[model samples]
Target: MDKIEEQLRLQVYLARCGVGSRRKCEEYISEGRVSVNGKSVLTPGTKVSDGDEVCYNGRPVHPEKEHVYIALHKPSGFICSNQDRDGRPLAIDLLSDATHRRLFNVGRLDYMTSGLLFFTNDGDFSKLMTHPSSHVEKEYVVTTKKEIPGELMEQFKKGISVQGEFFRLKNYTFKGTRTVHIVLEEGKNKELRKVFLSRNITLKSIHRIRVGNIKLTGLASGRFRKLTPREVEQLKNQALENKKNNRGKPKR
Candidate 1:
C-alpha cells in the first residue's frame, strides 16, 4: 500500500512555519504576498506539500526548528499582544531570545491583570487552548473592595444576564470577605468585572492562577519556563475533550 500524501492549506502551512497566525497568513495570501514553488498563491486555501518551497514577502519561510511552549508569570503592566503601538511593554517581549520564533499568546490577560499566560509557537495548540468551544477552565484569585452579598453570590452561582448575554462562574470560593477564588470555563473578556459591576462590586485586583491543569506556582512575575511534554499533552487532551462535548453548540 502506498502512503497518502500530506498537504495543508497555505495559511495553515505558513502558521506551522511560524510566519504568523493562521488569520494573518490568510491575509498575506489574499494580498498576494505568499508564494509557493516560485509562483505567488493568492488563495488562502491553496494546498502545499512538504516538498514545496514557500516564501513570504520574498523571504523563505522555514518550518519551526522546534515548537516552544512557555508559561509566563505575566506582570501587571505588560500587554498580551504581538506589537503595541503606544510603545508599552508586550508579553512577547519577555521572551527576548525566542522573539524570532513567532511565539503567540495562548489567550489574553488584560494589562491590569497578572498571572499564568501561555506562549507557544504551535498555532494549532494556541487555537485549541483559546477557542471558545474548547471550554478550558481558568482559575483566578480576585480581590474586591467590599464583601459579596449572599444574594449576589447566589445570583453568580446561578448565572447573571449582562449586555443581553448570560454569564456564570463554574465555581467560586470566598477566601475572605473581600477575596474570592473563582473558576470559569467560558472566559469572556473582563468577565469577572462584568459580574461584579452588575452587583455594584468594585474590583481591586484580578490574577489568574491556573488554566486547565497548569498553575502559576514557582515562576516569579515577568519570568517564564518551558512546559514539559506531559503538560502540553494534558492541555491538548483537555481541549479535545471539551470540543467533543460542545459539538453542535453555538460558539460564542
Candidate 2:
C-alpha cells in the first residue's frame, strides 16, 4: 500500500468534506459505514489523505472545491436533514442546483416550522454559527391560537422552565393579540414549542425571520439564494463579537 500524505482522522475528513458533523461521522465510522480505498473502516481515528478514495454508504465523499453559502426560506413539511428515515422531504433537496456540492444545513428548523435556513459547505463556518459560545441571536415570528396573557409575556422575558430545562427570550413583543415576535440567543431543540407547551399556550405556527444580522426578507418559501460576500463577513463578525463578549459566561 502507498503511504498516505496529508493524513487526517477519518471523522475529521468526513466532516471537512461536508458529509456530516464530526461526532456523526464518528458514529458512521464505528458502524463500519465508512470506507477508505475500498476497505470498510470501523475506527474513527483511522487516517486518510488526498490520495485515498473515501466512501460513505457506498458513495464517494470528496472535499468541495469551492465553499458555498446559501440562505434558504425553508417551507413547512420539509425536514432539516440530509436523509429522512421516514422518507419525508429533506431541506437540502430543495437546492436542486447545488445537489452535487455536498451542502448541509447549519442549524435546524423542525418539520412544522418554516423560514430562514442556512446551507453551507464550509464546516468551520457551520461550527462558528452553531456553537453555543457564539451566542448568535435567532428571531422568530410566532402565531398562537389565542392571545398570550400578559403574565406569560413576563415569564418569557424572565425565563421559563420546561421539562427541567430553562429557556429565556432575549426580547419579545406582541405584534397583535395572537402574534408575537421573539428573539433568542440559545437555539435549543424545539425550545419555542416546549416553552409554549409548558405555559399551556397553544402555538399555531412558528416562523423564523432572522439569524444574527441576516433577515429573511425578499425570499420566498422553498427558494434560496447564495449569500453575498459582505453578508458572510457580517455573520462571521457577529459570531466573533458574541464570543468575545460572552467569554467566561456559562453556555445555556
Candidate 3:
C-alpha cells in the first residue's frame, strides 16, 4: 500500500534525487531514461511512492536525506561545469569539504567574472532562482579600464541590440570614475561583455554582488557557506512574488 503523503510525481522524485530540475527530469522521462518497478515509465505525472524501485539513467535513485543550498564566493578562472574537456579548474571543486551530495551550480558565473554564486542539490530551488519568469535581480560591480563617456552610459540604460541580442541594465549608478553599480533582471550570457565590446569600452572586471535579496557580505573569495533555512524561504518567496507580478508579460 502506498501512503498518500509519500507519493509524488515521478519527475519530482527524480528532482529530489539531485538529477536535475523538474523540467529536465521530465525530458529524461520522455526519452525513456527513467523507470519504476522494473518497467520503463515515460509519463510525466506517474505516481511514485515508497517500496517502488526507481531508476534514472539505469541507476537506482532515492531522495536525498537533506536538500542542501550553498553560497560560494567563486574566484576568477574557475569553470562552472562539473566536467570540462579543457581541464579547467572547477568552482564546484571548492566545495569538496562541504558535502558529498551531487551539487550543481544554481546559475553560472563565467570563467573570467567572479563573485557571489550558488550551488545546490535542490532542483526546485535551482529552477526558481534561474527561471526567466522569476525575474530575480543580479547586481554587479562593473569596472572599466577607462572612464566611460556619459553618452555611452545613457545608451546602455536605453537598451541596445548587438548581434541581434538585446542588452540593457534594469538600473545603474556611478560608483566612481571607473566603476558602475549595475542591476540586471535577465542576466543574459555575456550580456555586459558583448554590449561593452559593441561600443569599444574596455572592461577591467565584472563582479556579481547580489542575487535578489541575498547579498554577498562577509563571504571571502574561494570560500563557501550553507544557506540558512530562513534565507532559503525568503528567496523562494521573493521569486514567487516576482513571478506573480510578471505574469502575462511578454518574454524578452
Candidate 4:
C-alpha cells in the first residue's frame, strides 16, 4: 500500500482553510488572528496533521474539498498567476465566469507565451505538476529570430545546461523558417527562452501545445474545459510513477 502523508506547516494549513496563502497566513498568525485548539500560535512552521483543529478570522476552519480542475488555452498577455499586483491581464480572469471555486494554476507559462494551462483547487495535484521533481512533460512551439544552425539543433537534442539548470529537449524539429517544435519537462520560468538564447537563438513567440498527456488541440485560446476523468487519472498515475522514478536521483 502506498503511504499517504498529510503533513504541512501550520500557516499552510490555515491558508488551505481559505484564510489566505502561506505568506498571508503568517500575517494573520503574527497579528493574533489565528488559533489552534483555542490558543493562538504565532509560529508558521508548526507541524500540522490531519484532523487538527484550526480557527482563523474568528471562524473554525475546515479543509477545503470541493476541488475543481480546469484546463485553459491561455492567450499571450494573460499572466498565469492568481493575482497580479500590476493589474495586468491574468489567467484567473479567464475563468471568472467559472464555478467560483478558488482555483490556482497547476503550473505557469510566462505572460509573453500562450498555450495550455491547468488550474485546480486540488493543491496536491497542483503541487505535483508545479514541483520540479514531478518533471511532467510540457510541449511548446517556439519561433526564433534567425535560422537555427544544424549544430545547435544537435546541442538541443543532446541537452543544454543553463547556468546551473539542466534541460533536455525531448523532441525538436523545424516547423518553418525559424519555428521549432520543442518538448521539455522542466517548466522553470523562461527556461525555453533561456535555452535557445544559450544557443544564440532569440525567441520571438512561444505557444504550449500540451501538458503531460493532455493536449490543447480542439480548445481555442481563451476557452476552458474541465479535464475528463480519464485525463485526471492519467495525470495522477503519471505523477506517482515520476515520484517513484526520482526517488534517489540527483536534483535536476
Q: Count the backbone clashes (under 3 Å) in each candidate.
A: 0, 0, 0, 0
**C-alpha lDDT of residue 11 in model 1:** 85
User: Candidate 3: deviation at residue 104, Å?
Assistant: 0.8
For residue 186, what is the lDDT in candidate 2? 79
Q: Give the residue spans of candidate 2 off by over 4 A.
A: 1-7, 37-39, 43-52
Colliding pairs, model 2: none
Cα error of candidate 1 at position 220, Å: 0.7
Model 4, position 155, has a per-residue lDDT of 79
The candidate that wins on lDDT is 3
lDDT tens readout by residue for model 3, 152-218: 7788788888998887788988988889988998888888898887878898999999998888899
Off by over 4 Å in 4: 1-8, 11-44, 49-61, 250-252
Off by over 4 Å in 1: 1-7, 20-58, 98-100, 245-252
* Cand. 4 Cα-lDDT: 0.78
Which candidate comes out best when scored by TM-score? 2
Locate the minimum summed-lDDT window of 10 residues in model 4. Answer: 1-10
Worst 10 residues of 2 by lDDT: 1-10
TM-score of candidate 1 to 2 decimals: 0.83
